[model samples]
Target: MKKIWAPWRMEYILHVDDSVKCIFCEKKQYVLKETQHAMVMLNLFPYNPGHLMVAPKRHVANLEDLTDEELKEIMALTQKSVKVLKEIANPDGFNIGINIGRVAGAGFEGHIHIHVVPRWNGDTNFMPIIGETKVIPEGIEKTFKKLKPYFE
Candidate 1:
């Protein structure tokens, strides 16, 4: 049996009480870019190396709740996230999406956000299939540092 050490996941595991507060509403230390209406930040538990989330500053669960300005900024930031990931990670492709509710896989169900996941050729390996574990190749802090400068 091979062990994959992901120390950062411990923070998420210990602090995953949703009743504490909405994650998007909290002071995000890993924010890559922030505008008046929206911000882009690294996903604490990413699906891939450069996984990011774009969300409106205002807490709104539904898409209909977003103001036109907020919607625009969120989309713009999403595009910027893709560009930055392309330059830094050089991914073969991307998976950008929004999960509306718990059933749709929205971990933070009350706050609407867009997920921008960078995908590479051969990124899907046997570990996830057989071992039931996904491997993240880089540390979150390292990825954050690499991405922050581009957003600035």
Candidate 2:
């Protein structure tokens, strides 16, 4: 069996800080775009090169808790995210979803957020299937920089 080396992930594995309960509540430096009620930010651990998350500014765990304005802004931001990614990343398709609970695959179970994953033709390959690893061609910081200008 061949091994995939990802030394960068060690930082996430070793640093276990329980104090910061909700990641969405914190002031994010890498927020790509924001409205009065919602914001979009790059995923620190992305599924693809241009993966992003859109969420309501208020700390709401469920979709039912969102106000009409919040819901509108969140969906607007999600749409904008896809548009921007298409321009910059030129993805063939997208996977946009919101995992409501932990069982539904939400890493931040208490915060409702939508994930926008950009996909290209033949992006899924042997690495993820056989090696159990996902290879991101670009660095997160680099990708953040590429997408930041369009949002601004």
Candidate 3:
């Protein structure tokens, strides 16, 4: 069994700052895609290199709260996100999902978001199973820069 050393997460885990800002509501410097109802942004703690999240603009705790327009926009943005990742990374596949509540593995259960993770061949390794860590090759800021222009 090999142990994956991810020292970078220590900063996020150790530093606890009290802010009322919701992860999805915070105005980001870089936005990958945005429609009237939804927007896409790079995931700060991603499961893969080209990981991104599609979220509704309005604050909603669950998918059921989204209107038909918001739902359609989010899905459309998700598809566009896939296209961008394909053009940029040419990933072998993708994993798109939404975790509803805390019990469903949502880090921010108060806001609804869909995760789009680009997966390459042999992307899955023992690190996740043994060390419970995900190894993402690129940083979120770098990925944000790479994807931001595509949205415009």
Per-model root-mean-square deviation over C-alphas: 5.3, 4.9, 4.2
Instruction: Tell me the tens digit of each residue's lDDT in model 2 across 51-110.
Output: 999999999999999999999999999999999999888999998999887656677778
Least accurate 10 contiguous residues by lDDT in model 3: 9-18
- Give the lowest summed-lDDT range of ten residues in model 2: 4-13
Please give the TM-score that candidate 1 achieves against the real structure: 0.88
**Which ranking of candidates, highest lDDT first?**
1, 2, 3
Model 1 CA deviation exceeding 4 Å by range: 1-16
What is the Cα-based TM-score of model 3? 0.82
What is the TM-score of each predicted model, taking all chains together?
0.88, 0.86, 0.82
RMSD of 1: 5.3
Please estimate how well model 3 matches the true structure, expressed as its whole-model Cα lDDT.
0.80
Weakest 10 consecutive residues, lDDT, candidate 1? 4-13
Instruction: Show model 2 residue runs off by greater than 4 Å.
Output: 1-17, 27-29
Clashing pairs in 1: none
* C-alpha lDDT of residue 28 in model 2: 71
Better of 2 and 3 by lDDT: 2
Question: lDDT: which is higher, 1 or 3?
Answer: 1
